[model samples]
Target: MPAPHSRSASTSVLASGSQVQPIQTPNVPLDRSLLLMSLAEEFFDAAHSIAPSVTLSRTGENVEVYEKLISTGLACLDTALSHVRLAPRVEANIRLRYAGVLYEETENFMEAEIALSKGIALCDRNHYYDLKYAMQLLLAQFMFKKSPKASLKALDSYISNAEAYQHISWVYALRFERAAHSLESSSLTDYHAALQNLRSIAKLAGEQNDRPIYMMASLMEAMAHLKSTGPESMEHAQRAIAAVWAYQLDSDNRIPQLLGLAHILDVACSLRQGNPTVMINKLKLMQTMMDEALRDPTWSTTSNVIAIPINRAQNSSQVVSPDTRTVLGIGNDGRDNLMLSFVSKKDAFSITYLLCGMVFLHRNSTSDQKGFKYLETGLNSLEADMRAPRASSGVLPDCIATLQWRGQIMCYLNCYMAFCAAAITDWATAKGHIEKVETTARDFDVPLVGPLGSVLVYLTGVYYQGIGDLDTALEIFQGKTFELPAETGKTNMMNSADQVERDIALLAALNSLWILQDGDRKNPSRNTTLIARLEPLCKSHPNKDIETAFNLVMATVETHPAAALFQVKNCLRAALNGAQTTANTQFLCITLSVMCNRFFSNVVGAQAEKSAQAASVQAQKSGNILWRSVADGMLAQCYEVNGKAADAKFTRDHAFKLAQMALPDI
Candidate 1:
């Protein structure tokens, strides 16, 4: 008899090298079962090449060809497991393969794991690399969603096997092909390196004609790279953008959204590089691409836009309808707010983006009349959009999310304006803006706001402190806050990750001083625990944000004038070393200025020593005079207060000179 044709076979299923008839299971086993087995196994070899055909015997009705094909494959396992100890190698492998699928379908994880493992072990132990790769492929998929840790460990075990086996050629795929799962594991720390590996995989995939796998690999690699901003990060971002351009896609491929994000990175990088042309182009590209995406049918719904609340309204029409103005009974664009009586106009994403953009725009564009007007118009549009209905008819598109949280973005934008206003001593405006910010913050699951919320919570303490409400402010400064945890898998290595508990504790402590009665907020009456909680953090992580949190407690709560000055100087000096644009540095310096002028802050001798130390450190170059001047002035006051007549005159002269050099505006 000729050899049968087939490739895939399960434990009891036998695929052969040629098409053949399926043998019936006999109740009276008088015939040679092996002959029937050989015929039944041939279908798999050419399973993809030839169409399936069904045939009925005298005892049966004609079944569909596909159904007959699946049944034939499945029947191989039905009776083979009972006699696995007696079966030949090929028979056992076929039976084990089929049995694995059945066990998995029935949620018999242990049975499936054992059957697959045994088949794989046999192939692996015998240097059957191709079969081993196939087995690994099947096994990993099952484990990835369940025991990722175990799957990762097992994959490492098989890597050596892949390299040693002769049958698995270089052309054969890697048995340990789970780079993503590896990246998601605690074993694989470092987002930057993970990004490089993913990029390499995407590059390797580009050489292959496997459209689905290659494209998927490219997208996954792109997302992984973007999630972690690393060295030459823009290159990975550009690669992702280029991947999208490689294929002409008509629909929203998600690849274009990535491409748009690459544009944002390009814009920011260009802005930093002082190339306004490149920055403008990238910014325009981002806006254009985002606008295009807003019209995407598949992603046009709120669920899809919820992740990017600011992006949904990029394609929406006018913010204020002509009909809306008429219905409100207001004259054209008079004193009335544009959004006062308007219906829903935009989603959350749109509102968040416009507001944040307006912040930087305001700082950079007040000189341009047209640009200033555009900023106000943008703000009006945002408010109108925010008033839009969350859902329609209670039957939202499948793509729209039912719940959304964008408080961090809103808070940052609002607080940004408030902060700038406060820094410039425009207290009335700052106070009004912060009040709005407080309202917006109530909308989110607080700790989920990440670093942005942390900054806001910290700043709220400063605002109260700035208003001379020291006791109230001290409680805010000492409030407990949960540090938001990393959103990526716990395995991703990133410095300074915050946990929810930490942020909660930090915020809670800050809130305490503000919420407590006057007696509790005074320095002498303050809780001893605040210093205990803060002192350890300052000692353990001298350069971390925790240290700044500690400094905040001292600056607001401590009654010792000299100690508050010392704490502020310590924070400012540390800021000189840390290369980050955190609000910590600004808060530290500003609070220092306010502290130095306080009646209780009269310790002159120590102030002079610390101020002299701060001026010499070039690292705290904030491009502002506030830091150095405050330090210099404190030094001058220290000499005067201690009655060092000559030193006081010299210090005062140096303070003026340094203040002039540090800030032209001041």
Candidate 2:
């Protein structure tokens, strides 16, 4: 017999010749079992030579090692299985080794499954029960990607047969993983199962005084509640925050990840409560925590568009923690998790930038441009990262995963841009963004009108309305809304059912207002139905600005000119004060136009006229041609009321010129 050939590192070292003993060749032929074991050892040694651990790869050089390992492993396993016969023990070990190598080194799930299934069968038939549970666990986990229900069944079988062998953490981790997967579907049964799993973990953690587990479980439970729109979601979020505060000690980083999550949940709950001020504060805190996490030099740099471990808190929190046990290592796991290559620091940064930008856009309209700039930078970084060659997708193709995220981000960014453009009467810009989003939705196979669909549609209608295409706008506003799909990619302001409802209410109200202005006073019944729908939506939500707009529309529908004048005056005062203001130029123009109508009808006082004049000056300074036209028209009406006929004619002609310039080209 001769020694097996070694293709890797050389065993010959001349400098240490005295200490090194001569290798001896056996005279007998090697047994099948020994040869199989030797092959497995050689495969692992070759793999380890390039990578410290099979799971971690910090450099491109390690990727080359993985490719080499896969090729060698496949060849060796194929030769051994084809030509050799071995004892049950050796056979089971070889199959398991082959399965692990295939799973880690390549995307060939079929081969891996065949090897794992064979290994599992060997363990079962020979009563080699020690490896059975581990093999089942791996198989079940893999099945989670293909079929969650099948994975759940396997998990149940494994638990039933090997309860004593499973670790406590493993038990909880599996349950959490199942619950997380169940959320992908819209079935109530799945939601109930997820809730039950979280509740069980929460109860056990509470009983054992395990604050960390309790914190994570409670947060997840809060998210589950949010998915179902449960009444107790906010309370659960508060409880999670309390748990963190209770166990947290001031140290290095001070549990930044936990604190960041708590703050994010707080922002979500606050938004649901319609508390913009509170949401803004929470967003600021979350930004601070994320900045601290990114500043830590220990975190590994990633090549992919790393989603901040903080997703919109739903859709996918897997990026937050690799597994349940790793949740405890939040800030610490950033680098190690990035090495896994599923997420990157840029993903996290983009999300934080987006949230902060949202606060600026909503809370302070004056800073809306700043918000757009922030979102633009985030989106650009995301696109660049996604197109990078080194990016990895865990189970799906990297390009497909990148497209999904790109579609998701563009959906929100374009929607927000539409709102900003519509506010300033930039109809062309607004329409362009909406069209891009519509195309993106179609290309990505996402719904154009799901949870956020109504808002997108509403914005489209508003753009038409701004251009004086009232009939087109009305048709769109009154279009039928389809039922939403069970799974939309992600949940946020741009894609939530609540946002859709709110937008629908506003759209309907605006449509009715347009009908009344079009001199369709003969159709009071239709107008009444629209007003009736708008009243409830406006009253239910505590957004003062929206309520103000609703009030103005309601007064117009009721033909109460004085009341309309009062609302317009209030809007002007707020816009001037810049506190709780509806400072949008287009809306200001509408209010001023309403005031001009009231003045011509002898329905307003001297103070109302003065306020209207002030609003006109502000609108003229806004740089939107449509609003400038509306403002000039209001001034022309004021001149006519004051009996200045010559001045009125000159101003009316100027208003007409501005209106013509503002109109969109057919």
Candidate 3:
């Protein structure tokens, strides 16, 4: 793969392998300098090309080859540096670039970032734009993940240097990196500018080299169109997906291709206006294949520097929910993998939203039981991020929205966990956690406008919903202010498929409201105006989540015992099945157990009996003491449900006894 190393690249006095005899500066340094310098330049170029092979082998086999290559390259460079006629700055710039290559190859990101920064600075200071361009490319991968701010500076320099070099691809790559770091508040100007830069690069795009960058840029632009346009967004998305497929992007840039495609399809599905479901299925298949493609190879992606504020690209593209990236097989670092190996913190930042969206999407996507683990794992992973962000411990003011949003997710997370505990009748912990969720939500203000609105509505409703007040949750869920058309969090960063998740979150929020709203409508929450406010949505969407929730609400109502049973069973079967598949088993269990208990009106024996059954089921599956107690307590309630007064009293004693057995301290 390498051009042959030639002996002519170096000149020798005595000819023992071009080994330099010490030079005296005074005599005749500039005499044959032109010829020697030319030769030295060729060797330096060769060394740069051969440098990456150091990573290829550790065995004796290519060891000498790499060593010889480096030595030859270094020998020529050493001679060049030693040239008495050369300026000190010129020699230092060259040496600095070589050091950058070394630090980069060794996976020493900190030193690498430092070296490359200094080297590029040296190039800038000397006005050597071409050399700066080359080294800037080397520094690209580090920009977004480690330091978006610094990355932007480097990328700016890279772009300036690139323009001088007339390397169009470099500009496109820089745009992509810029888009990666765009924050929620970042305006459409950033998106537009990035798109403009990308389009400019596409003008110079060619087919001979299999233009992955062109394909990727096209895909990104198409998605951007979805957000910014109405009638044309679909057309752009369709055209983008087609280009990727037609260009056989599957084999070339499979990861970005499938991800982009998945994003569009997911958005379409979430919009729920067309046959987006079929497209979502097809996208999943492509995604699987894409994952397979990334199996063996690890490609290099160096970030570019851009000093200008990222211009908003056209968001005509469908707002992709953040969920599309978390699907495993995306080759996330394994738990054991060193955290330092990550390419960019921005990349990691993007993943968190995607994970949240996945959980949301999974809960709503299907009734299939198989999807549960995926959803749960994603949520757990999202929950795991409660630890402070790794990029920096100090939260920047710009990230307050992110922090609050995270708190909102925690509210949902805690509720989901509480529901799970309740499902098995694990009352004690479930009650405590649910109360905690209530407290968290109370402290949080659901802003009337912005991303937090929808989430706030969802979180507030879920808390009340968890506490057996589905009516109130439904009223809140109906607030359109909270319904973001897409993953608002990704206002700039890649708007992967987030709409689907939003739809699901809506469903859960409404379910909380309607299910907890009691049947005592004579007072009708006693608020006729409130009930009227929800009539429009119920008429349109037919109140799906709340439909079941309403039934659960009625189940708990004093008047309709059988209807309540039916409603509780209906909610349990559907919600449980849905939650199980999405890996949101906790939600499934919580809804079921909570609904079941509500129907019994917190009757002593009934609550214990129902909980006991669910707990038994859990124990068989997990062998946990908490689950066992729930089952035992509920079994005691079954005695009361049997209408035996003495048996009921006896069951209570046994219930207390079982609770102690299951929880020693309690």
Candidate 4:
């Protein structure tokens, strides 16, 4: 058979007297067609540039303008190709551009798929190898949201094709995509495999002098390492930071978006290290970086929105309800519309606000209000983004569009809100927020075994504890168990999700121990049994809060009065130090109340009075009615010990009223 048709091949006819005549095809004027195509490209670029802004605004007027702009571009392409023959390569390029605009700007995905397939067919017929591969990659991206398994299969075939063709860059890109898919898998094994692949890619890219790919791989490696536990994780984080710093120093290689992401990683690293002071300082610096990025016009236009890749595993049997769709901002088409993995400047700002709120809430009573306000501001921004109207649910929104990320962030916001409200004795509001989280978890199909679910479980226990249902709270706390993996003579690093799950379990156990000690003051053996189980776990986990709580429990169960007093004083000193270090007023108040009770029972009137007064003040600052009641009750007993009968009666009545207010049934 003759060679397949080539765009550059010419057809000629032999004529009489050995003369040859060339066959000509009808075509547009080269210059005019070139000018039209160039204009079309400009229109496409402009449309893309303003897409984020349009998503942010979501006004009908803005949407209309965006639609018109893309339509004009498509019209120009049609005019250029009207009744004219163009080279296959040129035609394929134009078709691909048309497909992209359809996919991105118009959100006409079906039409875009048709256009792309046509372009790919043209490339295949003309043996345009490079363009064919590029179109295939684009096709994979398009298929990903609709059918991830199909997309992955297509990507795997492309990776093999790239290798067969010895296309090094394409191979790296394809492998990167594969690794990214693995990273999104729920399996820990897949996650680790992805990390290893990313590290290899970074090393290879650096050796090949592909700076962009190198930077991307390095940054991703750093982010993965940041989610991990142990000293080696910290070392990896530091190395990644240094690498990014080096890249930043090369003015020619500076990327504002990558730099901003690096800054976030740096702050997160501090948080992972549990250094409040360092994390706070880094947060301030990050805020400055974010502000600077917003102020730069070029950055605002070009890099305002960054895509973070994610692929959520969906259950085919469960169809999301209409109400669930609305709550999740999903489109009416029943497609996973919110699966687009994009984060905008507004999203970054809101995330920073969240981090600030979390820090302040943990820091001390003085900053609790500031923390709550920050959380409110962030939550409002996110909610507004979700409420914005979009032309189609299938179209990617301009906000923090990733479903998993958005859902997780909202859960965290609600969880923290519940905690803050409960601290202030707003039981109704606290329960309302908790219920919202449960609703979100159900709507999003968040697995109970996941990090978000673990948090919800722990907080539910806290809610029961706050309401004075000690039995129920104790059961909830004791129901969950976390066991360390058996040592294999190698360091076993836990990822952030696993770490969170384990921490929540530890915290629940600590709560259980507290309940056991409080409820069975005469049964020291029961407390001893629970403490025995907790010590090994706490030693392995090594959390400051766990350690302090364990110490307090052990002190409470001491049988000898003198030894009990000495242990209580030591525990108080430790708690005071922790409160100062972390600025955690709630912990301080709890410890002081316990100390006040100890002193009151010992008939140390003056010491009990001082501890009770201090505990009450701290409780007031924290807005914790439960702890305040405890303080007042202890002070009443101290008054009785000092023979102040009237003072004792009044204080006791006030304490009883506060208890009733905090726990209506009791």
620: Cα error in model 2, Å: 7.8
Q: For each candidate, what is the lDDT?
A: 0.44, 0.57, 0.44, 0.65
lDDT of 2: 0.57
The Cα error of candidate 4 at residue 166, in Å, is: 9.4
Mark the regions of model 2 whose C-alpha exceeds 4 Å error after superposition. 1-134, 141-166, 203-212, 245-259, 301-343, 387-399, 435-449, 452-458, 480-522, 530-552, 558-605, 613-666
TM-score for all models, in order of appearance = 0.40, 0.67, 0.42, 0.67
Write model 2 residue lDDT over 571-601, tens digit each, in one string: 4444333223533444555555565555544
The residue-by-residue lDDT of candidate 4 on 1-666, one tens digit each, is 011111011111112112311232355333556656866765555554555555555567666655655677788787765644777867877776676656565556687788778888898898766566656766777887677778778887988876666555555656677677766665567667677777766776666565545666777788777666665787787797777677666664455666777788887777666566887798888888888878755344313333221111143112222221211123333332212133556667677777777767666444347777878888888788667643322332433245446666777888888877777777788888889888866654445567777777778888888877888887788774434334322334566777778778777876766666574434566656656666666643434656666666666664322344565688677766666656567777887777767655647557767767787778777677777788888778888888889998998999888888888877
User: How close to the true structure is residue 340 of candidate 3, measured as C-alpha lDDT?
Assistant: 13
Candidate 1's C-alpha runs over 4 A off are 1-197, 209-256, 268-386, 389-403, 432-435, 444-449, 470-475, 478-666
Which residue segments of model 4 deviate by more than 4 Å? 1-129, 132-172, 185-215, 247-254, 298-342, 364-368, 391-405, 440-449, 478-493, 517-526, 540-542, 557-577, 605-610, 639-657
- Between prediction 3 and prediction 4, the one with superior TM-score is 4
TM-score between model 2 and native? 0.67
Q: How many residue pairs clash in each candidate?
A: 73, 8, 69, 1
Provide the lowest-lDDT 10-residue window in model 4.
1-10
Cα RMSD (angstroms) for every candidate in the order listed: 19.9, 9.5, 15.2, 13.1
Write one digit per residue (lDDT tens) for candidate 1, span 506-595.
Answer: 545645543443563355435455555545434434224455444555545544333555656665455433223232334445444544
